[model samples]
Target: MTSTPPLRQQCPPGACDCHRERLLENPDADLRILLLTRNEEQRLLERLENLKDLADLQRMQQKLQEQLGIRLHIAPGFNEVRTTRGIEFDFEDQPGLCRKTRQAIPAAIRRSMEKNPEIAWRLLDSHDLLGGL
Candidate 1:
């Protein structure tokens, strides 16, 4: 008998990469962004500074998701796609499909820090860029 295909589609490129990296780097941990929102930049920084083990982070993430009814999905192709009409914070990273998706945002951020600080932090963290810190 032939097997049926899975109901869900393959995750976008960067989504899997991010999730894989997180797992490989910390087998049971999650990231801080999963618990915070754009308006909570200060809180996010604080959490990042005090970030502990993976299990702790996982608990924090779970609590935040439960409390806020939101969850952070780490998959390969699912990146925060930015386009002419504002950024789709959860858009998948598809080549040629989203020209502005997953592209650099540091310079744009530097040009106007106040306008994109929170989003910039999210993107910067995702790219594993801590150089400016």
Candidate 2:
């Protein structure tokens, strides 16, 4: 007799229903905190440390719920964007924190700029102002 795969194992529970619900939901209804930065190795560790703080997490959670009308969760993960000189940091959980961190990128860049004045000035000069606009 040939062995057959279990149905439950083959098709997990809530797969169809949950995916359907998520599809029906608004695209922007879910909040995504993306961290786009250059020279990630220098700042990744420090940024992760800041994110692990309790006060920062709480504040971020509150902001997501209040501003985006979506519940937030925080997970630790990062991705590299192709064709770009930067890394995109992604938080699966604590989206609020991610959003806040995204906002703080400029400040962080400024701080880094102070330390490496030469590279900072070069970056500032080379950045495309019109691209963002």
Candidate 3:
């Protein structure tokens, strides 16, 4: 007497629901994060950083527009456009921090001063920025 093979072996490739059964057997098997490689994790972190930067730039643009009474847009790669009372102008956003303002800012911390008083302030304040100070 010959015994029957397993159900999967008995059926042709597309004739069985074995694939669905395997998935239903383990629900979390479909989660991509569980299979992420080191490179994938790094890429995800970089993408998050880029998203944060874009959000910061947009917030700065909004504040500048309110302060200057203009319609302002800050685009990527050093480009800015402002429209005031129907007059529009474009400008390149170059780093304009004075040499003194670019110095070690420990004194600023001691004084509890958060604003830069010359250019932009820190978007995110964290211990990492202090470099273990």
Candidate lDDT values, in order: 0.37, 0.37, 0.29
Q: Give per-model TM-scores.
A: 0.26, 0.26, 0.20
Per-residue lDDT tens digits for candidate 3, residues 1-133, read: 9983222122245544324345435755432212223344344334323333334444544643443222333221222212111212233221221122112122222122222211112222121332444
lDDT of each residue in 18-79, candidate 2, tens digit only: 23234325576343322222233235435533443334444645764564333544322234
Residue 2 CA error for candidate 2 (Å)? 27
The lowest-lDDT stretch of 10 consecutive residues in candidate 2 is 5-14
lDDT of 1 by residue, 1-133 (tens): 9984222222467654334334336645433323333335344334533434334334644664565333433321344434312322232322221122122222222333234345444444555654556
State candidate 2's TM-score. Answer: 0.26
Judged by whole-model lDDT over C-alpha atoms, candidate 1 comes out at: 0.37
